[model samples]
Every structure is written in C-alpha cells, then in structure tokens.
Target: MSNPADPFVEELRAITGAAHVLTDDASTARYVGDWRRNYPGAARAVVRPASTEEVSRVVALCATWGVPVVPQGGNTGLVGGSTPDASSREVVLSLDRMTRVRRVDPLDNSMTLEAGCTVLAAQEAAAAAGRLFPLSLASEGSATVGGVVSTNAGGEQVLRYGNTRDLTLGIEVVLADGRVLDASGALRKDNTGYDLKQLFIGGEGTLGIVTAATFKLHARPDKVVTGWVAVRDPQAAVELLARLGDAVGERVTAFELIGREALAQVLAHGTPGMRDPLAGEHAWAVLFDVSETSALLDPTPAVEDALAGAMEQGLVLDAVLAASGQQAHALWALREHVPEAQRLDGPSIKHDISVAVSRIPEFIAEAGAALEGLLPGIRVVCFGHVGDGNLHYNQSRPPGMSDAAFRAREEAVHDVVHAITARMQGSISAEHGIGRLKQEAFLQYKQPVALELMARIKHALDPENTFNPGRVLPLPVATPRPSSL
Candidate 1:
C-alpha cells in the first residue's frame, strides 16, 4: 500500500537529522545535475551529513534497503559522477557540512582536513600554517578536497606537485556496510601491505565515501617567477618546455600550452583587466612557472635565463617575464579564464585527454586536423598542462553559428576526436573521470579483461551497487560473434 522508498528516506532522516534530509525538488536541484549541465537527474532525497559516522549510517541503511547512494562534495565535478540518477530511487549524500581543518603539523609537513573543505580553503589553511598545499585548479574556489581526492584531480601545478594522489598521504572512508576504514596514517613512508587508501582515491564514489584526508604539504617557496612565452608552433612549444625543464629542473612547477583560437576567445569575451602577453599574434602560447629555495638561487633570474636561452635557440618567438605580482596574476588570469571564455562563445565540445608528453604536438596536430575535416568550420581550441600531457582539446562552432545547431552535433564531433585519440593510444577521459558522459565510450576503449577486473572490484566492495549506480563503468553490452572463415 505504501511506497518502499519511503521507509528508506525516513530511516536516513532519522539517522542524519530531519533538517539535513532534503526530499523536496527545490532543495535537491543542486545535487541532481552535472557541472556542464549535461546529465540532469532526480534523486529520492538528498542527505547532508556532517561526520564520518553519519555517512557510514546512511550508506549502510541504503545498502540494506537496496537503494543506491551518491556521495557528493561541492558538486563541481565536470563529469556526472556526483549527480544522482533520473530514477528518483537513490539518495544523494552531500559532505558540504563536514568542512573543517582538523589538524596541521608544520613540522611533519602534513594537514588533516575534512572532506567538505574546499581546495582553496585547504590551501589557505596550509599557507596560514606556513606550508604549501599545491593541488591547485581552476575550480579551487568551489571544488572540495573530498571530490578532488575522489576524482584524483590534476591541475596546472601537477608538473611539479603531482595530482591529488601525490599530495594525499592518507584517507578515511565509510564503507557500504557501515564500516569505517581508517586508512589515514600521516607517515611519509608506509609500505604496509596493500596501500588501501589508493583504492578509493579515484574510485568515483563507487567503492566508498571519502570522509577525510591527510595531505602532505611543502615548504612555501621563497621566490616565485611566472613567465608567458609565445611560440611559433606546438613543436616549438614542446621544445621550449624541454629547454625550461633542463634549465629550472624540479623548480619548474607549471607548464601550460594555449592554442591561438583559445587565447583569442579569452581576449574577446574574458573578464576585463587581463592583458595579452604577446605583442603580435602567435599560433600558440606557453605559461611556465618556477619556484626555488632562497638558499640555492633566486627564481626570477633562473626563469629569465631559461627564456633568454629559449629565444636564442628559436624555440620561443617572444616572451614576457612578469615584472610585478600584479602582472603575474594578470598573466595567469588569461590561462585561468579560458573555460569561462569558451562557455561565453557558444556550445563547445570538450575532451580532457592525455598522451605521452613527447607525442603531444603530434596528437594536437593530427587530432585537430581530423576533427576539422569531420566537422568543417569548427575552431579547435587545444590547451592545458603540456608538462603532464593533458590537453583540454575543445571544438567551438565557427563564427555566426547557432548554439543549438552546434550542440546538436556534439556526439558526432566527440566520436571523431575520441576515435583519433584511441588510435594514438591516448585516453578519452584524462582528468575528468568516466561519469555518464564517457561511461559507454570507456567500454569502447578499455580492454575486456580490465573491465571485468573493475566490475569484480565494484561487486566485492559494494555488492548491491548501492553507491552511485550507472556511473564510471557502463552497463554491459552483448559482444558480437566473430565471423569465421
């Protein structure tokens, strides 16, 4: 006579306060959709839990009721990993209220933080403690530490600091059966059996809900230098990157590349007060950042020396080393504001892909040419972490095209670009995980053996698939028979 889903909601409400359990459509709107506004969905209810115990209780209850649970943080994930399904049968577990800097040991160079803390907030906390938290991103202002850890996000600084995985020393997770896995041990070297924390680092909430993490921090650099260099081509940019790496070595923190069209779009529609670094138009641009110890050398002179050498060798056509902090911020703004500028231009198809660092130039040239051939008049805006070989290869409609029309062709264009990526032994989803957007595509690229292994892990962990169903791994498809001679 009564709905089966009702009791589950009631139980969840009882566990994590009635005020924290949201069932109404209005309150769940933010948790029901993806960042790109691609996969809007509905959930039975949304649960905001402030502690690991509450999260464990909700997950256990949902597991018992055969109801799926989606763990969310900040809701800034580009993929649909955090969004609930449209079935309205799942419960969304939000970690926004658990924000706190639990501990900061400057002597140990580590900080313990709750899952709800924003990336920027963690950085600030570390800075206040006279340490550095270097997991920087464009969405740092809104992206939470838990979500960053869940996705294992890599940003501009990954060249030197590495991704979220490298920064994380340990994690605390709430398992499906109301069990808590206390994997957080702040030691720098732990060779304990099977590193369990890594299992949930990039699990996309399929394994367990990440409640807290202990991140390794670094000493704040005494000197910082940022440079913007113009290159004649992608090859030249790659060469300049190599030269800079040789010159600065490990101090080279960030190395990013921007195509001509991407920069043009940014200048045309981006936020005001950011000046273009180059005097004349160039085909591509590279932003390289350097940080060093005062005991050894000053980073400004090192960066300047690298640029001068690059220019002499013809790897860099033109360059500008930031004269002041204001200029440095302005130069970085051009790179940071690219995504917003792309959105303002029109509907754009995006691919966060990675290849071998040595093959980036070739990948860009070949992939761009292939996509352009498939979709005529499409403007290729290829840019991102060249040092890490991750490119945000996006395609925008040519001037005067309707947004609706361009958007309509998104799938076909994505296929073309992704196909080339596959052929080149590159990834379809790089920084962004395979949420709903690329779940099916992941099947096309991933080996059959690997898929089976992933499924086994998922089943072993959350036997009922009660954590974020219909995500990461695609629904199985029937394999066709091979034609025999």
Candidate 2:
C-alpha cells in the first residue's frame, strides 16, 4: 500500500493546487497559533481552499483519511477556536482565499458572501448598495464573516442590531463527510422545519464548516448623534438606559459603559490627540448614540432633552454632547482603545461575563469586592456593552507582582468572579464563544442536562470529531487511581 502520509499530503495538494498547500514550518507556524498567543498548536500542513466545492473535497478527503481538520478564518478570534492542537495529526483549513461577494440584492436587503470576506468589507459592500450591515466590531478590519458567524460575535451595536446569529438568514456548510448542506436562501420568513442553519451559526466549526452565508441588512441611517455622560455607577447607567429606551426606543443604537480605571488606561496609552470626555474623575461613564434613517430628522435635540432630564434627576453627574462628527469618533476611540491599552499595560486576567441589566451594579460591586479581597491590590479593569449587561471585566497584576505569579492565580480569580456571576444567574462567556479557553468553565458552570444535550448534538453531527477537536466541549476527567498499598 502507498504511504498514508505521502498520499494524504499529495491528495490535499492535488485538490487545492500545490501553491495553496503550505507545508513549510514558516508558513504553517502562523496558522498553528491563536491571535492572543495563548494557545500554540502544531499542524502537518495549512490548506487554503477557494470555493465551497474545494472545501467539500478537502473535508471529504480528510474524513476518509481519518485526519482531523480545524477550519480557520481571519484568525482574529479572542478564543482559540480557529487554531490547531499540539498534535501534528491535524490540518488547518484556512478560508482566507474564499472571499467573494456572491449576491447583493438591494431590494431584498440581503447579501450573500463567501466565508473569507472581512467584516469591514461586508460593511462597505452594504454601504455601496445603500443599505446597512449593522454588525460592527473593533476587529472588523481583520475579523472575517465566517469567524464572526461561528462565534455569533457581539459588538458595541449588539443592543440594537443583535449578534451574528440574528443577522444571518441562511448558510452553506460543508459537513464532516464533505456533504454540501446548501441552505443559503434569501427568504426571511421560512417556517420550514428545523431551522438547521442555527446549528452551524455559532457552532465554532465544531459541527461543520460554514463555507458561505446570507446576511439580512437594514436601511442605512442618515444621521447619528453621539454623547458621553458620567454616571454615579452601574445603577445610574442602567437607569439612564431605561430612560433612553423608553423615550427613543430602537433609535438607541449603542450604549457603552467605561470605568474610571479603564478611561485612565485610555488616556495613558491612547494616541496623543485622545482626551477624556468628562472633566472630572467619575467612578463610571457611559457613551451613547442615537441614529435615524432620515437625514431631515435630527435626533440630537431629543437626545439632548433626555440628557437634560437625566441631569435634573441626578442620574447623570456630568456629560458632554459631541459637537461634530470628529468629536463623536474621538469619544468612541476612547472606548475602543481600552483593549489595546490594557495589552500595553501588561499581562492581565480577562473575563467576559454578563448579568441582568437590572442586576449589573450588584454584580460589579460584589465581584469587584470579592476579587480585591482574594488578591489585595489587584487592578480590576471593568467595562463593556452595559446596555446589554456584558462586561469585559479584566484584572491587571499589582505593581510588585510577577507575571508568572499572577497567571498562576488565574483559576482562583475566575472562580471568585464566575461564582458571583452564577449567583446573579449570569453567563460566564458572553460575546466570545466557548472555545478551548472556556471549555472547562462551560462544563463547570453549564447545567448538566444542557451540557449533555450539547455533547449529543456534537456527537450526532461529527461522530469522528473531524472538525475542531478539543474545542467548545471539555474533555472527560481521568479518575484517580486507587492506592496499591
């Protein structure tokens, strides 16, 4: 019989051209690791396929050979879902070359795009059609549609437009056996049966590889009004959101909460032109925007009136309304730069958790206190899409602490915060899907029945575990051996 390894590599090269098959360690090294540099994996080769048919063939060949495949997009995922494992038995299937805009139906307000299209590219395509693809993210320039859909990525605008799952209407997936499940129809109200598209939407490529997707679009907003307001705390921020929602409803596109420490990081590490929106130091702040589809209808007056009312009621301590588009963008930069600033500051423990909007204050206050008590002088950088109750709560090490020591205590820190999150009936992983990083937490915090159901679904679809092994689901713990004495 022919050598199995030789034939497998040769078949992959024949399927997607030798140029697309990368075997050199230099090229393969980049695909084996994640963006966060946390999970470093090893792969025999990295294959680039350009079409759904090519993907189908590749997956089929891998399935037949019993070699695992990990599907990757732009490689901008926060979690290590797109990276391979340490074992060299796997192959990385990258979709970066499959970027093509299949269809743009302006009348239907929907667009069909290949998996590799960048999020920014999709937004620009929608704009060209005089429509709006409201899914926005800080990583939009590098984050791909396939990756976003797999993670059901939530961004600053999730409060109004919802996540990737909400925007996706149809999908074309390549199954484990290389079968093309083409459900990429443009219909909106198809009450047709299982609505199977959802399974792969946020599956993180565990169930199948999403080759292409059809996304629902909206009418482009003609005007946008932005503002920055200082609030007493999370409670006040929640109340202000309630007040604004009661008044403006869907026009309220984005509402973000930034803590004083987070803002300080921005000022310290941000560009020279960046400035704090509020004059004085406040414990908490909120950035909001009101958008309208009609250029003639200015929403600023209404937003200003609401702010005035909020100030009168003492919900807002201090505030600033953007005088121009430049100012609005500047204010937004402060919020967007928090992640980069935190990175510059040094190593930190990160947690993306959510509680009920009403209970956000209690969760933060309690979780912060608990973490501080656990590790005295630990810096808690808490902020996120507060309108939706998701907080990117992170902890920076103390001045005298070593990075290794801080990392060693990561589990203890997560336990304290996740415990409090469980108490509030909150999610341990929000926005970011349960990739390898949170698989342990998924098993620990997720209900037994729910986890069983998830495992059942995973097993039912990809029995061979050919797609993204060691992701989303935690491995079974080995039982301790009995004493031999």
Candidate 3:
C-alpha cells in the first residue's frame, strides 16, 4: 500500500490540497479501473488538480521524481488508455476536478471548456447558449473533454459534424517536464506552420496532458426526426445511408446500424419496458436521426421519401418513424443501451474496426463467416456507425463454453478478425485507439515506417517516457543516446 506520508504523495497533496490527493484503496478504486473492467490497475495516488497551472506543477514534480504519470479524465475509456497499469509506482493525474466552462461565444460558435467537463454537460451548455456541440457518444455522460480530444472520439454524429479532431478548434497541453502549451483559441483558419494541436488531439496522453480545449458548435436543431428501419442486410443499410445523404444532404446527423443479435441482448437485459421498435424479426436494422435548424422546414417528409425510394429498390424491409419527442428518445434508448446489455450478458471479445464505407457490407460478411468457421456457434453482436464505416464487431462464446476457456482463445479470435481487417485495408482500431489491448496487434499491423515515425515523435515530445507509457505504442521508446567525444 502507498503511504500518504510518503514524500512524493505529500508533495502531490501540497499541490492539489490533501483532500484532492486520493491514496486509500476505497477512494482510488474508481480511478484505477477501465470502464470495461478489462484492465484493472493500481495507482500510487490519484491527484485531482483544479487548474492548468496546478496540472503543470504536478507534472513537473513527477518528472523530477522520474515517476510515471497517467493522465486521466473520466476513466471511461474502452482500451485501458486512461487507467494506470498494475504497478502502483505511477501517479494518476485525474482531471475531473477541472470542470469549468470558461467561455461560450455565440458569434464564433465556439466554447472553451476545462479538461474535466463532461460531454453531456458541454452539450447542455451549448443548448443553453442556443447552439449545438455535435460530438455524441454512448458514454457522453461520463466521458470528459480531455478524454474525447485525446482519443479523437467518433460517435453517432460523425456523418454530419465529424470527429472530435474535426470539432476541436484549439487545445492547451501540459507537456513533459511541466511546460504549458496554450493553443486554445477560436481560430477557424491559421495558415502559419503545421497544426501542432493535431499531435495531442489523438495522442492518448502518450505525448502530453490536455488541460483545456475550444470546440466548434453548430446551430441547435429545431426539428429532429428519428427512425428505426429494418434493412435486408448490411449492404442494404449502407445503400440506404448513401441515398439518404444524397437526398437530404447533411441533415442526416446521426446513423447507427444494429444487428439482430445485439438488439436481442438489449431487449433481454436492458432497461425494463424496453421494447423493439419493429415487431417482426429482422437480421439487421438501422437507427438514424435527421435534424433541421429551421422549425418551418420538416425533415420528416424528406426522410419518408428516401425510405420510400429504398423500399422500391427492395432495400428496406420495414420501418418506423418517431411521431413525437418522447418516441425519439425511446428509439435512441435502444441504440444507447447496447453496451450495458452486453455487459449484463457475459464476457465477450470486442473489436472496434473500420473499413471503407463501400466495403462495410463485405467486411461484415467475411469477418462474421470467418469467426463462425473458426469457432462454431460463436454469437456475433456487430453494430456501429455504419455511416462512417466503423463497427463494434464482437464475439460471444459458444454455448456451454466456460468464460475462462473462451477468454483463453482471445488471441486467436483477434488474429482472425485483425487479419481480415488488414486484408480489407481497414484499421484494427477505428475510434477506440491502440491502447494496451491492441498494442501488440498495432505493432504487428502498422507500417514499419509509420512505427518508426511514431517512436521518433514520442522520443522527441516525451524523452523520459513520463506520460502514460505503454498505453498506445507497443513498447517504451528508448531515449536517444548522445555522441561522446
């Protein structure tokens, strides 16, 4: 156990106040575990600093002590990116204390928020200002600004508003050795040099700690139309989205593809009174939303026309549109509760992958077949933002298989899935990032030159490997040696 009176822990207490530095097992339990419970960790102490300056100071002190620092926001990450490792020598720098909305500019359509501001809270703030922050995620209530920006998160709205990287205008980072880099501003265009903030946007805290950020906001939708449509297959769902985009342009804000198996799990284990939107059993379904800024213009008719066209082409099997706001929320509930349902069900090996939008159907078909061939009766729960070609392709164990026996085959399962992903020229990791779970696969599949460049950047930005080591990259990048006389 880490002693509170230890010199380093005492220094952490002095920096963030004794109450903010958590060292006890009870107080630090939540910070050490990843959201999925796949990577439970131990931390020497979780220090919650309120301001950017305090973060900088804490980081600098850790550098002086040669201690590892795991920069954490809400700890709601999937791949063990934000949680510490089992070694209790590392200090978890928690940003949840720094929840402050510094400013909201209506004219600029920008909002500056401290690192700990929750995604849901940010959206609420934007709504209060009569604007919209379009980055939406299943974990939005607990996922923090710093975590999203660090992971460069992509959620349901990527079809319209883009990823966190696209929405981010500027950022403020605390670099190794405690240097503060203030890049947070509302500049839409600056053609000076390379965009440095891009490095930290998806760096996963391997490069630096993101303390604050400025994000672009859009006009709040006056009308939102949500629909649950059963499709013939993945190909049909893909075609439907393309046709919808062509018909309504950017008004199609969110698009989600759900498999029948996934929906079954939700209905079985999700919230009570949760009923399927469509009565008939369909192999595949899509839940999507269309929003309009002008209340006078209804997107419903256009949506109806698009679905009608799809039906004419034998693409859509069945469909239902939410008639009221309550119905829309209920429709959304089915899509959002999938992860919880999976959790309640049992252990499953999950993969976050992406291929070309046109190749989504083929990838699913091939990958699903490949898994079934390898392990007979392996239930596949596949779904995601097909509009962006990303899917949560997961595998539940075959019936009568022990969890231990199933988990033991994880490497084989990943090998089959990742090989197919590579064959399709798709990413092994789409939005979840190359955290500890995928580091070996990343090193295996990533281009050798790209790995070299990543190593060089890590060495350049964090020579001592002070920030979140062994999270993204496969191994610790050795500091370069100096030439001697």
Candidate 4:
C-alpha cells in the first residue's frame, strides 16, 4: 500500500479506486518492464483508470502537482514507450480497466472502442457484427487499441487493409492538461481543418493519452488461401509479388519474407509440430495469403497459377500449398513463431527497418555484407512484410564472442543497418515507433526541420514535457563550453 500521508498517492487512489492504484512491487512489476526484458523501468504506482473521466481527473491531478506521466496500454510495446522511467516518481497511467466497446455502427462500418480493448477483442467484435477489422499483429492477443493507435502499428494485413492509422477514423484523447479531445465520431470525410487525430495516432503517448478510438471496418473475407514458397532471394520474393499483383492483385492480402535462419529457428525451437514449408533448406522463403470476401469466390486456383508462373520465372524454388485451413494456420504459425524462437535462442541486436519494395534485395545484401565485415560469422535473422517493405532484421552474436562483447556493439550494429537504410532511401523504423530505444537514432536520422516542427508541436501540446518524457525525441544538446552568461 502507498503511504497514506502522501497526498499525491491518496489523490491518485481517489481518482482511481485504491484497488486500481498498484504501489507494491509485485503488483507493478509487469507494468514497469517491456516484453523483451530489454528496457526495464520503475514507478511509484500503476494507476488503472476505468474511463475517460477518471483518466482526465488523474492527468489533471498529476499536471497540477507537476508530476510526469507515462501512459501505458497492454504493455506489449517493444521499444519501452509505455514503460515508466527508473525515476520511480512518474505515475503510470494504464488503460487495462477501460476495455469497453462503446458502440458498433455496422451500418457505417465503424466501431468505437475504449483504448484498453485488445486488438483480438476488437477483431472478434467486428466479426460478431459481420465485418472485418483488419489491423493485426503477433501480439494482438495482448496489445491494446490505445497502444496500437498511439504507435500507429502496422501488421500482417497492411498490404490489403492498411494499418491502424488507416483503419482509424476518429479518436478520443486525454490531453496532458486533462482536457478531453473528443473526435471520436465515425466521420469518413471531415475536411474542415487539420486532422488533429493524426498527431495522437503515432505520438507514442508523448502528446496525449488515447482514451478511445473509432476504426473503420471492411467486408469480412469468407475464404482465405494461404501458402508458403521457397524463394531464391528477396529479389525473387519481390518479383513474385509483382507476378501476384498482376494476377490476383485485389486478393493479395499478405506477403511475408522469411530468412533461412529465421525459419531454422522456428523449425528447431518453435512449436512442437513446426516443420519446414518445403523439403530443402532454401536460403529464403515467403508466406503469402490471398483472401476473398465473396462467399462464392475461391482464389485458390488463381493463386496456384500465379505460383506456377513464379516458379517458371525462377522466382520460386519450391512451393507448399496449404491444403486446408488447418494447414494454412500451421504455415502462418511458422512465420509468427520466429520472434519467440529467436528470443528462446539467445540475445540479439534487432532492427525494424524498411526500404522501397524495389530496393529490398539490395538493402538485404548490403546490410548483410556490412554486418559480416563488422563481425564475421555473425548469424543474421531477416524476415518481414515484403509487400510493404518492412523487414525485421536481427543479428546474433558470433560463434565465440561473449554476449557482453556483442552487446557492446549494439550501437555499431544499429549504425550499420540504419546507414544502409538511409542509403536506400528507407526508414529506420517501420512499424515500431521511436521510443527510448530509437531516440538517439531518430535524432541522427530525422531531418532537422521536421525534428524542429515536431519539437514545436510537443512544446505546444505538452509544454512542461510531462508526458512520457525521454521518448521519441531527445532533449536538446548543449555545448560543453563554459556559460558565457
């Protein structure tokens, strides 16, 4: 229990019932650490607010007391965005108790949900309404709407249905000053002024806390044909995408590139029933899906012919067509399980980078060579949504190098990957936001004017820098010279 004499704790307890304010180490442990165990944090208490009103009150109280706030959702973020700092002074404002489907307008093809609602819950709600909410991720079971919107997450279906930002029509945010910025209407076209919601969408809880969101829904695909193929390289995967685009372009829902090391990890250490999609140990592979909304349409034949064409063009080495829905799920499991497999294998330096779809091959080849030159015998794990140019590239320590030595080279690894990314006109971050993990790189890579404007916006919205401090943006650097003043 928090000290009753501390008026701040008592105030927090009052804003959110005592049961919701977790002060003990046991209760606050999960909220203070990220999933990767890479960025651990500390907080005095974890405050769980149940509604926008409660959130506003808590934020107001914190602002009045000049206390910094860290907004958290499902706590599934990879970049420590939601984790509280080690200061132990910041208040963790969690939305776990705010899971509510406020409204579902099936006629408008929209759904309004509270921020704490899990991505899977949102999908099930849409399915219940005979619609499809397409934003998805491996962490969907645990990731929340607020986190997804705040990070503007992109997932497997981005190739067809777009990301959370594209699906989100409106949002409700609790500003740092405790004002409710309610734009949660299901407006498809409201061109009156600047889209204020976009700022909060990818803000990573810096500008404000997303309390609720309104997301667009699509026609639920009745049938989905998924398959896996062994491709010669990333270029082959790109060409295969072109071929599929030429044939079943409308139905090409997902195209993921999986590296050999990624697949080997999955097959060797992943789920019990996991196995390679093809017989041989190919250098690279792909997992793709074609979905059709109409009940009468089956895209299997078209997909088969396209795969055949890709094979004839030497784009695909071998193919494995999922015979049933069960097989399709198994294949996707192979892709989804890579992250966990890698985690189980050992520590690694990770990169979430993107390049133009056309330049993926070059990026992969150059980045691989550069990393090899930096650290010979390094194990590279590269895989991602090739259709959209996002790649989850990771590097494990060399055979005999100690984990400490490899860990010491993390900044160099990031530099190499990001340098190649910049050379290829690519983004340093694709789906992952610039949380504490990428703040330095963000400062180094982001254009100066853009960074200045972002700083201005941050100042305008959160002048005190009370919201998720030391995230997304770094504080201005001062020269070491003696103060002339």
lDDT of each: 0.87, 0.90, 0.92, 0.91
Residue-wise lDDT of candidate 1 within 77-114, one digit each (tens)? 88788988788887889999999899999999999999
Tens digits of per-residue lDDT, candidate 4, 163-186, equal 888999999999989999999999
Predicted structure 2, TM vs. truth: 0.96
Which has the greatest TM-score? Answer: 3
lDDT of 2: 0.90
Q: Sort every candidate by lDDT, greatest first.
A: 3, 4, 2, 1
TM-score of each: 0.95, 0.96, 0.97, 0.97
Order of all candidates by TM-score, from best down to worst?
Answer: 3, 4, 2, 1
Error of 1 at 194 (Å): 0.9
> Positional deviation of 374 in candidate 2, in angstroms?
0.4
- Candidate 3, lDDT over the whole model: 0.92
Q: Residues 386-452, candidate 3: write the lDDT tens digits.
A: 9999999998889999999899988999999999999999999999998898999999999977777
